[model samples]
Target chain A: MFFLRRSLATSATADALAIESDSGSPAKEFKIMSGVILSRPPIITPEQTAFSKAYYHYQSELYKRMSWTFPYWFYYPKGTLAENEYTRVQPKLNEKDPDVLFNRDRNSKQDVVFPPRSVQRETEESARIYAKIVPNPRTTIADEENNIRSLERKLDRTLYLIVKRDGESLEWSFPATTIESGENLESSSTRMLAQYGGEDMNIFLVSGTPALYYKDVYESDGKYEGAKIFYLKSRIFNGLFKPQKESGIVDYAWLTKEELSSYLDKQYWRKVAGALSKQ
Target chain B: MAFFKPSFGTDLRRQSTAFFQCRSLHSSAPQFKSPVSIVHPVHHRVRYKKSILHPKYQTLLTIPKWDPRSHLFKPQAVQPSRVKTHWETTLAPDLMLANYSHNELKLRGRKHQEWDGSSPYHVNRPLRSPAGNAMATPDILPRTFRTVPFVTSIWVNTFNHRAVTEHAERNIPSTVMIQQITGVKPAPAYSGVSIMQWRLRKERNVGAVVEIKGAKKDQFLATLVEVVMPRVKDFQGIANSSGDKFGNISFGLDPEGVRLFPEIEGNPDLWSGITGLNITFVTTAQTDPEARLLLSSLGVPFYGRERFHNVPNLDGTKQTRKKGVVYYENSQE
Candidate 1:
């Protein structure tokens, strides 16, 4: 115990610094920030090229032709309502006519034919089953007006949220916030987003770790170190963005990757090009 | 693949007599584009160029589908698949970022060891098994762009007790049921061991098994997640601890649940006592937790206590248990 005490005394040596810290140097201090790259995924299937359309058609045709003939008796028994409807609608092929080929050699047509409904009032299930479906228009009002803030503008491509700060001279960038002393990048980003972005939006941060990071330099009153921003990926499933008046966010717009290049500065876009989705 | 790839294929190996009843020698219409001509009973034997069979091509009797010069070579990706598009456009980037670890260490997999070679008997001896009762688990490789998980294939199986106790032909429905659901022909499953209590003999047909991959596998998954699972009454979802540690997550559907499939649901009367179906999603992930994450992201729900220990905890404590070490945590916390 006496030897240990002596050793401890000898080690202001090991535990304490031998020299004083230099406080007079003018080294820059970087301000850490977390940037959220919030994006809305495609809501609809993308338009196919001519080659793909033709290929799908050809494949479907091939499948239809190669498949075995459908078992008609299984669905339409001897004297069922479906059988009656089938018999009434579809006529039997004449055996005498050699030119009539669909029934004789190959039964390529396998789809069941239902009798046109006019005389009989069908049940709710049957009516719903045979109801003619009318799909909504692909282009919405948002697309026509060229609304950049509208989430519904681009239905097929991923749309990212870019914001302009309160000042008029400020540049366009993704929603970003300065990290607090004890806060991590993800939590700080989420907190800033919720504080300004309002509770209307339902967002899911993709991960805890940042996907990417960007470094910068600043010269204000002195040669100051600019912000070192870490980008965290997030996705908005469904909701509207309510930009707060006092939250320093002047305006916000949802833009595709292609449109982002034109809105954002060349330097900023260069650093962000790798993280943004092309589609 | 053989059907669509072959440009001039003679798939007339099994021509029904009724199909060949037409008394004409004229060729049929352009029914299937791949087949150049259909063989008739009149000309039962097909004649072809004898040069293909010659020893010139290094005696590669099998058709070289990869060779561009061969008729079997088909240009791939003629049509854009919905599943493929989703993976590329929406799923891939998000998954990569979500599964990324800030600081992960690469672990060496426990491999088979060699003898010290000190004795003379070690000359031609085989490598020894891994140490202890634990299996040679795969290396916990850090997640990277290329290491992201995906479903490689799906194993669909159905075992019928009637096939063993009753006549062996009872497994016919099982085979047909498996084929109907999977859209792929299945192979018969035979019992390896004889059970006296069950009256099952070795080599007896017990079930049917099919491994679905490529396009059909995606299609089956889509149907299961979208239509079948939603229709299942009071379903509790797949159990959280369902994987076999080797990244293959398996689950079974009761006969009623199996019948809920659109393929089987259409005609339930025909399949009165259909056996339950067991589906195993074989994935590229090396561990169970990673496999579970991939599956859950792909729309499969997990219920019960989720033990995501197989995957390296990135967000939370990140205290990964070392090999041969017992982990303890106070429940009071």
Candidate 2:
């Protein structure tokens, strides 16, 4: 009996040592719940470029609240109502010929409207282009496109600020869009970035819900109609009021994956990230 | 035999034995009967019964010996050494001790006065004195109150008076008193105010008025610890409502009635307009002249400053700053 007990103890000790020295990757890796994939050097064709310009001009009339010396223009489908849905409208739109305006006056396009020039160079240049990001293998093509566009907006802001600081000018070409199935969105974005521009660009993958919830009623003297009561169902989720379920509010807030973790929300995003990592 | 004086210096062991023997025998006749009982004398035998001595009295009974080492005392050696050793052998030998001297001193110095060293472990206790008492001093210091200047602007509320009152009362105090008090808990400051202005479709020359009634003079002053003055949302030329209307809280002087809190006699505008109030209480004096003078001059009217409201257009078009407070309008493409 003594020998048997001794043998068991030694085996248990060996197992513990093996576990300690295994050097396998951490049982779980850090993952953001909301996945944001970024890409650049957008898959812009000549036709798409014309559409983008037309769409930009059309929306600018309403949202811009101002007219520029150089006319603001964009293309959109004839009947679309959404203000910023340029991608939806651009492909099916047309523009009045610039020839009419030019013939009426007589000035070159560059002479009529020139972008800000760099002191160091005659013309502005793009900093870099073409980035791809793969969020999770399960990420849908629609969601990936949305995330990429959002990332593009963020990058635009950042680069604008950077280039402006260096006393340089910048302009971005129309971003290209495509749906690659069952591929890594992040790695794909990176590869695209490398091919079109270069890989020195800062890349990030973020997972988050796109919605933000604020206590509008609390802030706005109860005049805010959007505030809805939410009932706590369990640790992972809350059920919003039935009346508000259709108001595009699934949770009290739309948070990035990191924020969800900080908020002690479910580790659903981590699982998604893990599945993505396998892919 | 030679006559010899007793030296009185005997072996400690022998003296204790002899002294105890005489006392045990006289204590009681029954106790002397047994050798074991006599040697070990039953506890509480009361060989010499006397009243119990207090600790101070007992301590006083023993005199400290005078030794030459008293002059050699040094404070550095008086502190105990704090070296720790690992008997479990789990910790590494080369691991440096976490030098916690600064932390210990900080904790000890910051400890509240009520913390008693008698307990083996320290427990948090409420401060015996007011939290501010630590900074109170007999010396008089300059009393200053900071006021944030606000531009005249209109506020639109889609709710009625009751909802407005409840909401304003909840959020206003923190914004109001953040400059003065610490740890402000929500209370009933909002209960006293009567909401006077309610317009659904935007009226002319009509302003929102919040009147705090029966307010103890310094009560409002107490709320301004870390005041957050709301930014005036800018709009174009004339608001849908005039400067006389919209949102501005008037105190001491009513929106309709003009009384200057006995501090001002010359300034006529004191009866109306947006005036910021900030004053420190040395001992709650009701009347301050400078505060009144400052408040009275607020609505003197910004003459010629109206031209600055126009935003220059890039297309050589005149884009005037319109009336009413503007919300965020991002022109992002």
DockQ for each numbered candidate: 0.19, 0.01
Per-residue error at B190 for model 2, in Å?
Answer: 7.8
Across all candidates, the chain A TM-score values are 0.81, 0.15
For A1-279, candidate 2 gives per-residue lDDT tens digits of 001011111121111221222566433211111112221211111122576656655544322222122222321223554224432332221244333331122221122222332345433323221123444333345344544222222211111000001111122111111213332323333343343323344542221111111121223232222222111000111121121222222222222323334433233234322211110
- Residue-wise lDDT of candidate 1 within B1-333, one digit each (tens)? 133333232354223332455444445512322232443423213344546647876435565876545545544443556776787888878777666664666756666789999999999998877766455667767878887878999999988998777787888888988888887889998788988999988887899999998788888998999988888888878997698766899999889888878888866776756999989999987666668777877789888865544444333433335442212231111
Per-model TM-score, in order, reads 0.77, 0.13
Which stretches in model 1 have alpha-carbon errors above 4 Å? A1-25, A68-122, A129-133, A221-223, B1-61, B65-79, B310-333
**What value does DockQ give for candidate 1?**
0.19
Query: What's the lDDT for all of these models?
Result: 0.72, 0.24
Inter-residue clash pairs, candidate 1: none
Question: Which of the numbered candidates is closest to the native, going by highest lDDT?
Answer: 1
TM-score of chain B of each: 0.74, 0.16
Q: For residues A112-131, could you state the per-residue lDDT of candidate 1 as single tens digits?
A: 46557753677888688668
| Model 1 clash tally, residue pairs | 0
